[model samples]
Target chain A: MKIYIPNSAFLGNIDPFLRGFDPSDPGTLEITANEKWIAVHPAVLSMITALGLTVKPENISCRKLEARSRHYLVRMGLFRTLGISSDISIMEHEPAGRFIPITRIRTSEELSNFKNEMIPLLHLEPEQSRTIGYIVSELAWNVLEHSGSEHGAVLCAQYYKKSNSIRIGIADTGIGIRASINNSYSAETDLEALRLALKPGITGTTRREGGTEQNAGAGLFFIKSIAGINRDFFVIYSGDALYKLLKSPAARPRLHADPFDDRHSRAEGLPRWSGTVVGADITLDQTAGFSALLDAIRVTYRDAVRERLKARYRKPRFI
Target chain B: MRTIRLVEKTGAFAENKDVARALRVDELMPALERGEEVALDFTGVDAATQSFVHALISEALRRFGGGVLDRLLFKSCNEPVRKIIGIVTEYMQEGLAPGE
Candidate 1:
């Protein structure tokens, strides 16, 4: 396996970075980066850490990074997470209101603890904290419950000062969406599985309308709606398919049951990611009230269930 | 009626599904089964995830039918918590089988 860290890889232009990932040799991992500067979204680091964990420490090799901004990687704990030594020296500063380093959560307890500690570190407003907390909880829980990855979920976040937004990335080298959703639904392609996974009342655990008592199958939909209502970018990649909800231009963006129905872009036959990677950008400046967002969710969720039920309704026989 | 203080089980933010499940399987379900009304008091909880709310009440609705809502009381819920619970109940009812 091999990956190259480019100069810029935020959610908007992360496609080439993802496309460059080579998952050919699972036994060995090579990480190389540009020599000038290295700046990327938390999702990029999370993906590298997730992929690195799949190989033996001795088998993983990283080229000496000469980028002037190489310390950002060190600060983000990328090399430390992968168990490699970058041999770069830099002054350490307080991380408050800046970023969350690469952290691996393997249990529910860890996730709960992380959430408790995450808010203060970001120094966000009460409403903003709730939104971030909600996203991390839902995304990480999906990994813990369904990913089936031994290493669990790797996640990190950064508060972008310029955009006044929080960028988050979560990756897991476990069963991809196709495998998980196929447990109950017959989705033939990875993209189809993603479509079902995003829809309300659908889960890999069961085909029933309400899902199992534990999972309402509404987590992803809620997260997507949050991003849509805020007019931010949200991306999900599993196998060779990727769905990106493009940033909306409307003052009030409408939520869609089908992810493809939103202003979005997709790619098929890309380099396959064995697990799943999700990246979300939440612009705090324009965040909608959490309660107001729920009002919309309630309407869309009920409508989605009604549509599915109507689709299954039998037609009367003609005389 | 037996009242369960949720903040004691889950802190201000109730996102942990395990605690919700325990309260459901251990406390809520047993009390509902014994013909006692259960009031889930969220006196100090600020917010809750949809998953946690579903884990806590969706099963009771499934087993006892929608009538369970009549016996279950949500107390001291803030706006966000109330909305989350409302969403869960609405969707569960929408998905329930006919006559359930």
Candidate 2:
């Protein structure tokens, strides 16, 4: 079987790989570049590789894979890691930024060692190192908490020293934000799910699951706030919703629904991303100290935290 | 008089499970039994999450009441680490039962 990746606005076009996949089939698989110019999200690439890994096929190869762009380089690394290689110069091409290859965090050991692992890769100072550390920690924790993907979560990050910025991406082939939130409350649209997920106390974790004490549904909330305060760009794409928060001095965090298409009507025009991708791009120069960033969050949301705690503790444990 | 080095127990980026494993309640009972104040040293830890902070300190708060927080001193916490410990500790104190 051969899968062709397109050079489109986004890799939302790559969902067809999950179709008709057979675990026991021994068929050889090939992934190729379908267009002259190709760019893909690490989340989509991770999902494709994960699908190929799951079907347990005889062999996998990348044919005519182009490593022109930085994104493609990372995807090449991912393909290489999955034992897929092409007889092309793509392997020799270096990605534009210092890209951390896609990582799989399944065990507690991997998750705990994330900071130590990424620090040298990031080559960040103690302060900037701690900033990304907290960000990635919260993101990884969310994957373990909500993403029901059996294969675990995939993470990729790129540091652009020249631009003084870092972009970190984490995705899981699990139930996306819509399903996770709609399980508790009725979120009729993907945009609604994305919106609700940003609320301070709106967590998908339930009372019976020991969520009250462990989760305050503040992970994304904190991420959103920190990105905004730092004047950075943050994007959360899950299910059919693609919410991007571009940092502006006077901007309020708002979900700009896709004006081109409405999510509720099933007459599909664009393909939907299968999993959750939380991508952040923060400019290092404008970034505050990691501790001050967290402190700002605490001070800003202290009232919100108090309200959530009151609601959580007021309920009886078993009733 | 008993000081637990957080870096020795957990690495720079400490998780909740790691924090729990590093400083189990049973491990601290001996120090408390000897009437020694248990101080958690954060000399080498770079960052901590709220959940990790809560997991590490909640047991102590439960065993010795909110006042036990006073006996437990955090040493050499960086600004971010201190903020995490402070936020979690404050919330835990408020959520405790009236006497606690």
Candidate 3:
């Protein structure tokens, strides 16, 4: 399920009948505002506000105040209403504020136009913006590759100007994460598929170049680095298993690896996975080197085109 | 319609001296002179400095004179992208709220 269900009503305070996990014991399971909504459906993006939020884009404010679990959606709608260009970044009162809403558009042209319009809003430094763009470009392309059945996906973003943080979301009405994972490796369970995805080269594409780049897997790796330093977080859901990355040491790679050319066997464990809708939450930790982040992203803007190049040529000679 | 692009990729999100020149007179003057619908694309694009992106967007909207443009749309975006949009817009409305 998405972090949010569009048109969420009922004030979202109702207790939900959770599966797999129990929510009764507060001591055992710490329920944040997010957890409460996730219990109903993992895809819920929660917004906390005492009063209904007012969304301003360039001009007209929403005449009627409306509340949403995800303020991000409302944010975009207001942007559309006010007729702001894509180059503008929306700011929250605090570095991290809430209540966003976005409408799901149903066309590839529309998708392309929206992305082009919204890319400038990250409020990222020139460098950091590149990295964030790399992340967005990679994920957005994946949806096109994996979800060809659908015209395209709807994406929305939120940037915490104060926290110096941003989160980008892309969702499509196509195959979920499990199927994508299943296409790549022999994973009997959706959870297993999720685990395999976290590994460096477990891709479904038959050709080396065609598959998601090993370096591309590094996309998550680098995002993790930023989130780790800054205490940011990311999540991905595909198929049935929902995977949310907690920006902690357990989820990251060590500084050095033992160069196991032997390829004897993989590590003892992989990221835990379950069936989930495919979406990711990438949050930058507060302390990450903004320059490093920007530098890394800049290189991507210049070189990330390699992923696109790989798509051409039947042999897929290079990646 | 005014087109807004997420410029985190490169090229001033496509803003330039020509745009500055255009802005010196009226922000939309350049786009209008071209007889084009303003459109912004986030395709293969990335983040922009928040203030930078906001300022550009507001200026573009201002040029539209409240309704000359058809519509401003954000394309092929992700959740993180959506979140950033929310933060900026909410901030703008804060000061102008009727109660405030």
Candidate 4:
């Protein structure tokens, strides 16, 4: 038996091959490129294998894979990191920066190792590397806390020296933003859920569920605030909704949420991402003071939260 | 005065468990009880998240109240880490509010 996905089955395709895959059936997973150009995200294969599917890159065969973008190389690196063989020599090449190999962070040891390995690649000072490590840890931890994906999460990173930016991409094939937020609050759409998730102190966990101690719903909000440290951008995709938080120097940052756009358009009509993918483009400014930047964002977030709470409770703000 | 260096116990990747092990509130309680000031030196630490900061400090705040913050000193925190510590402190303080 064999399972194959042809063409550019990117992130938007979600689980193109796992709709009704039988666990009992012994089948080989194959990804064949029918077109001259093909692009695949790291999450696609990581999530599939995490869900009990035994698809190793060595076991899987690829045919006529061509690169239209660096994405092709990154995807190949992702598979190669999983001990799969490919035509591309990721070790010898550095297109933008090296891909940290799409990996599943399940245990504390694994997560720590991933962070340690990724930081040195940034080649920043001790203080600068730690800051990025902290941000990555919080985002990856969200997969364990919120996603509830049986397969854990898929994470890959790339640093573009020309752009002076580092991009960390993390995806999880779990109950998405809507399902997670809807667990406690009434979120009807993915966009609404994402919006609510961005709000500080808003979490899907309830009171009896040990919510406050485990989380204060401040992770993503902090990520959003800090990504603008040197005017970086943050983007999140889940379900049919795509969210982008853009940073500007002259004006305040803006968040645009669109239910229609998934950053990819398929003429054959693929499915929306069933999970969550967060891509953060952080501009590398070694001289910038993160403490001062954090203080500013802290004041802004506190004021916003205070104002919202004041309106909701109709009482004096006491903080 | 006892200075607890974070990097000594945990490497660059500091998590909630790492913080817990680094600063055992139960063990530190005796020091606080003995009127010894505890300074958390985050000099070699790469980065720390809100969760890691909150885990140990929140417990101390709950056990010793706002007075603990005075005895508890955070030193050598870089801009990014200092910011996270500040956020966690503020959040824990908010949780101490009346009927919050």
Candidate 5:
């Protein structure tokens, strides 16, 4: 496998970066970055780390990074995670109020601990902490409960001081959404599986209206709604399909049960990612009150379930 | 009525579903089966995930029906926690079978 890190790749223009990935050879990985500079979303790091884990560290090879900001990768714990030596030297400053170095979470206890430590590192207000913490919890838990990856979830986050927003990336090299959703429902394509996975009350675990006691299938919907309400970008990629929720207007936002209903873009037949990758941007400046967001979620969730049930209602046929 | 202090089990932010499941299967369900009312006291918890709330109570609602809510009480919940619990209960009931 080969991946090229371009000079700039965020949620907005990450498509080219993803399209550049080469998944032909699973036995080894070659990582190359643009010479001058490298700036990417946390999701990019997570994807690289997840792919690197599939093979032995010896099989992974990285080009000598000459980017002026190459130390950013070291600071983010990239080479350390893949067990490779970047040979880049830099002073390791405190991570507080800046970023969360790449971390691996394999168990529920690790995730709980990570949540407790994550909020304080960002130095956010109580409200902002709750929002960020909520996103991390739901996204990581989805990986733990459903991904079926032996290595679990690899994730990282960065606080963009310029935009006053937090960008998060999570990836796992497990069964993709199509396989997971197919456990209970039939989705013909990876894109269809992603659509079903994003809808409320739908889970790979069960087909019932309310999911199994453990999973309500509401995690992804809630995360997407948070991004939608904040008018930020949220992207999910599994298999060869990518669904991105574009930024909304500054006016009051309406949550949608169908992800495709939102202002979004999609791609099919891209480089196939065996696992799932999600990138979400939460612009703190536009964050709505968590309670108010919940109010909207309550109404939207109930209506989504009602609509699904209504769709199943039998019609009297008189011919 | 048996009151369970959630802060002792979940800390300030209650996002762990394992603890919720334990409280449900080991404490909440047993108490309900014995005909005792259970009050889930969230004196210090500020927020909770929907999955945690769902794991804690969805099974009881599924097994004993929506009327089980009458015997369950959520005490001292902050706004977000309260809203999460409300969402869980609302959806469970909305999706419950007529006789389930």
Candidate 6:
């Protein structure tokens, strides 16, 4: 099938994704397939699905990114997408999969509902839930505030037992991370904006009504921390440039590596991407310290959100 | 477009002589009956004194009835001035008075 994945696919057709190269522009695929179809990576299938394409798991095409490939960094902790010709396998496609499309409009009330209703279903501890919910809110805020589109975005999360992993994706056609940040830092050159976004305190939030710094420059950083805690793999694609936190720093935390080591080549062994459509993904094993990490974050957020509400409402003092 | 000339001005929309929130919408009902391309230009007009875009658009759409809302247009929308118009138009369907 001539499936049309989003031009933002985390690791879809790569040759054209490199900067200065338009995503719609085509490039030769290294693999030529027929018969049982191409054995593709799980990342490709997901990117396709996010674009609102329909592909049977059985037709999953497999292609591998070289360890040195830019897309390679995003492959952290994620299991390869396996073909499922029949539903008979122990792994079943989630029933809610098709209903959740990328780029859906959501209200603030719905955001609250996600925190209250779905968090429990995920069975994560309090802190885990808090951090997850916060991350979810950040993603929602990013879409509502930045996506130029009317419908913002809809998040689709699924759990696959076969590999004991959860895959979550957030997609939007908004001004994208690159465009929005560029607008914020008009002084910086294009390359400079990309580098600045990687730093800890450079969040690009100025238009927020009250302008809370706690949230302003911290979304990406917090999201990255959560991923690290989960020991999950991640991909961040924005403005013809993609950065993959492939291996969770936790698994092989970035402690020993020399940040100053400029031996040779661009971004040694890290994931790379080149696309304007913005988003990222992560894969983590349940065994990692996810349970404790999530618990701590959830409790912290639970207290914070609770306290904020209490202060705002004042307990409706009874005479 | 069903236009409302607000009787007074306030926080956001002020200075516009042609339209304001407290306008006699009843007076504009007949103009809409003519069913012509309507454009609300806030020229020489300052900010809208009161928030009437939502109510006005809702009523105009209802009076003009079918196939005309999209044809209605606006010009010179400042951020707040524009916000009222956007809130009304963007959520037009949802913002419709419940049963109406």
The candidate that wins on DockQ is: 5
lDDT of 1 by residue, A210-297 (tens): 9898998999999999999999999999999999999999999988898889999989888899999999999999999999999999
| TM-score, candidate number 6 | 0.43
Tens digits of lDDT, candidate 3, A142-207: 555555534354455565555555655555545555576566556775555555554432345532
Off by over 4 Å in 5: A92-97
Which candidate wins on lDDT? Answer: 5
Instruction: Give the alpha carbon lDDT tens digit for every residue of B28-64 in model 3.
Output: 3466556666555656543433323333444433344
Q: What is candidate 4's lDDT per residue for B48-97, written digit by digit as tens?
A: 77767765576666566667889999888876777777776665555454
- In model 2 chain B, where is the ten-residue run with the lowest total lDDT? B16-25
Per-residue lDDT for A244-297 in model 5, tens only?
Answer: 999987598899999989899999999999999999999998899999999999
- After TM-score superposition, the amount by which residue A298's alpha carbon in candidate 3 deviates from its true location, in angstroms, is 16
Query: Which pairs of residues collide in model 5?
Result: none
Residue A302 CA displacement from its true place in model 2, Å: 1.3
Screening candidate 4 with a backbone cut-off below 3 angstroms (N, C-alpha, C), the clashing residue pairs are: A130-B46, A130-B47, A291-B79
Candidate 4 off by > 4 Å: A1-63, A68-76, A81-97, A126-128, A207-211, A247-272, A285-288, A312-319, B1-5, B16-18, B21-43, B62-65, B75-79
Question: How much native contact recovery, as a fraction, does model 2 achieve?
Answer: 0.25
lDDT of 1 by residue, B14-56 (tens): 9898899999999999999999999999999999999999999
Grade the docking of candidate 1. high
Where is the poorest 10-residue window by lDDT in model 4 chain B?
A: B91-100
DockQ, Cα level, model 2: 0.36
Instruction: Summing lDDT over every window of 10 consecutive residues in candidate 4 chain A, give the lowest-scoring window.
Output: A261-270
Please identify model 2 stretches exceeding 4 Å from their true place.
A1-34, A39-44, A50-52, A57-63, A70-76, A90-97, A178-193, A206-216, A251-274, A308-319, B21-36, B58-66, B94-100
Error of 5 at A87 (Å): 1.7
What value does the lDDT take at residue A172 in candidate 5? 97
Q: What is the docking quality class of candidate 5?
A: high
State the iRMSD of every prediction, in order shown. Answer: 0.6, 3.8, 17.7, 3.6, 0.7, 18.2
Q: Model 5's lDDT to the true fold?
A: 0.93
lDDT, candidate 2, at A258: 25
| Chain B TM-score for the candidates in order | 0.97, 0.85, 0.48, 0.83, 0.97, 0.55
